[model samples]
Target: MYKAYVFVKRGFVSMLSYRMAFVLTLLGTFVGAAQFYFMAKFLGEGHEFPLLAPYGGNLMGYLIIGTTFMSFVGVSLNSFQGAIRGEQQMGTLEFLLMSDTPLHQILIYSALWNFLYACLSTSVIFLVVVFVLGMDINVNLGAALFILLLSVVCMSGFGLMSAGIIMVTKQGDPITWAFGTLSGLLSGAMFPVELLPPFLRTVAVALPPTHALIALRKTIMVRAGLGEVRSQVLALLALTALTLPIGLVVFRWGFNRARTDGSLAEY
Candidate 1:
């Protein structure tokens, strides 16, 4: 029991030790959000999307929320890659591995709790968007929460998997870019997917976030019921299934490889 407390305490201490980095992280994320807001305000002038008509309005508010939430989702899921890099840098991966408790359980709990903390902190700024900036956000309370939760979990699975890759090769830029850019370009964050070439639109739907962001547009603008979101829901479900299991499986393999190589403690 006391051991569990020590683990939690250690994680918090690690987070605090990098206070400057954390501050930079907070500020940088806020700047990114602001950049998106301005970009949307620019493109939104004197134009309309036909698909957005089903949602009964423009996509500006939807873009604000989508960009904000995707920032969370993108960073959160890819957290594992960054985390493994840190562990390697600390030169404590092996020492930590030697702990009495199961390593998987410890890592999962620590990662998840910190991710939740990120979500809370990010959401505070999101509220500022609607209130301070005076954006007309037609928020649907229930659907917003539901879709947000769905997005978070889906992203986490990707993060854990990416971390596993880092565990093996200690490199992640390629994987991160593969997932991040693909989602960014095709997921309809800045504009509708239909604007992309037909081939790109098809590929975009293959990315669940494409559907997820569209669903968010509908729920916030049209007050879409959960029933109205089967496509988005199913897409997220399928991606979650693929990402989580594969991530965990690869993570197990990577950890074992690190152990055998005596590189578990490599920084």
Candidate 2:
């Protein structure tokens, strides 16, 4: 935990050094939120849309919840890989790998700051959507938080998997790219999965974000309790159980392979 704190502090310092980037990031959050707000208005409330019936029939609310959750999902999916790639680019990955710290811990600790920043960004989006944009949300804060936790853990498994791939490839990562593209398209981030065709809906159901978004929308938009979205909760739990172990194994294997091939320091 202390290591995580140190990493976060370092990241904060880094952000401070890049004031314009930090400022632009915050500005982007507001711009993104406003875009969603206006897009929903242009599309109408969607109360007449059958696919949105279960989610209180509010287009803005659905979009806000989906986009907000996906923001965290984006962090969880890319942060670790980005950390590893950044370290490689800086010629520090090998030294870190040789250290006493377990490789997994190094990667996990490195991404901590990204998750923290994502939380800040997400809060900004939510605030802008609910207050500045006047979007009404009947949210169960406790349940919403729990769902967010589960979603991150579930998605982090995939992040670890991508991080492993980047450790070897040192460049393009098919895992993150494929997941990022497919997730945004099929995970119902901007629309209800019910609108998808049968086979596509099946694929959408298989993605972690789909379940996460459903649970988030239910809990945040309809103020549903944990039990109300228990199915989505269980799906996330199951995915976490299945993916986390696989991610660890894959990462360990990649680390060992890179070390054995004397390519750990190669970029």
Candidate 3:
């Protein structure tokens, strides 16, 4: 509870400090949505001489949502790195490792803060876009929330996997590129998987964001009910069940190994 409240407070304060950043982020997201909306309009209208109609007419709305919600996945992964780096820089990294509080809880809470803030922030902007763009997809909020809950579990688990790497390697640059490139391309942030090549399609399916995007699209674009998105829901559940705990365990091992190596704070 303390950690949750701390993060919530910090998120609010951080937002206050960077009001323009939030606005620009929302604007950029909206622009991306508009670009896709046009592409979908042209191609899906069956007047574009042929290309990407395998994606369905709702592709634009899918693109809009899939791209925007990706920010939350990015957040859940590196939540601990920032605070760890800060503590390390201040010579408290070792102290944290030595403290009574479990590192896993710390990491979980840190990611929770990130996921919570990103989701809450994006949701507001998403609503604004819905109103502003006049998007007409049927949205079942309850189903969407359930899918989102599952996606968060999967995403946060993937994040912990990355955190495991960070704990041992003390390098976030590689992690950044890994998340950025895959999240941008493989997740179909700008287009549907059907629009990608066959080989790329295989790789996209391996990503958690792929299912999250699909689930999100189902709820928002096709407006699929929980009963209808059984596959996506199962994908999310399976990913979360498999990956999240493994990530936590791997991160725990990494942290302990680093401590043994006397490099817990060494970047």
Candidate 4:
């Protein structure tokens, strides 16, 4: 935990050095939120979407929840791989690996800042949507938070798998790309998954993000309790169980292979 704190502090200091970039990022987030707010309004045409009935039939509320959750998904999908890639590019990965710290701990600590930043950005977006844009959303805060945590854990498993591939190949991570693309299209990030065809709907159901979004929308927009979102919660838990161990095994194997090949320092 102390080690993680040090890493987080280092990351925060580094980010603070780039004040302009930080400001620009915040500005970009606001713009993105505003664009989505208007788009949802236009799409809804002052009428509720039948597909969004579970989320209180409010288009803005539905999109806001989706957008906020998807931001976390993006962070969890890229954090580990981005950390590894950054270290390798900076010629620091080998030095870090030589330390007494476990490789997994190092990876997790490195990505901790990105996860924290993503959460902060999500909160900022949510506030802007609700206060500035006047989007009406009823939230069960505790349940929403729990669902978001589960979603992050599940997505981080896939991120670890991508990091494993990066360790070996050094680039060209098809897993991260494919998963990100598919999740955006099928995970109800922008629209309801119920609108998809039957086969695509089945595929959507199998993905963790789909269930996460469902649970989030229910809990946040519809003010549902944990018990009301029991199915989605169980689905996310099952995905976490299925993916996390496999991700760890694959990452360990890739790390060993990279070390054996003396390629950890290679770009």
Q: Could you tell me every candidate's TM-score relative to the true structure?
A: 0.83, 0.95, 0.81, 0.96
lDDT of 2 by residue, 1-267 (tens): 887888899899999999999999899878888888898998884437668778888888888777877778888888888887788788988788778888778877887788888888888788877777788889999999899988898988888888788778878878788878889999989887777899998988778999989988888888999999999999999999999898888777777778888887777
lDDT, candidates in the order shown: 0.72, 0.85, 0.71, 0.88
Candidate 2 — number of clashing residue pairs? 0
Query: Number of backbone collisions per candidate, in order?
Result: 2, 0, 1, 0
Candidate 4 has a TM-score of: 0.96
Q: Which lDDT tens digits does candidate 3 get at residues 66-122?
A: 766777666766666666766677787777667676877666665666677677766
Better of 1 and 2 by lDDT: 2
Rank candidates, TM-score, best first: 4, 2, 1, 3
The C-alpha RMSD of each candidate to the native structure, in angstroms, is: 3.1, 1.5, 3.3, 1.2
Q: Compared with the true structure, what per-residue lDDT tens digits does model 1 show for residues 164-234? A: 77777776445567778888888888777878999888898777678778777778777787788877988
By lDDT, the better pick of 1 and 3 is 1
Off by over 4 Å in 1: 1-31
- Lowest lDDT block of 10, candidate 3: 48-57
Clash pairs (backbone) in predicted model 1? 77-159, 88-267
How high a TM-score does candidate 2 get? 0.95
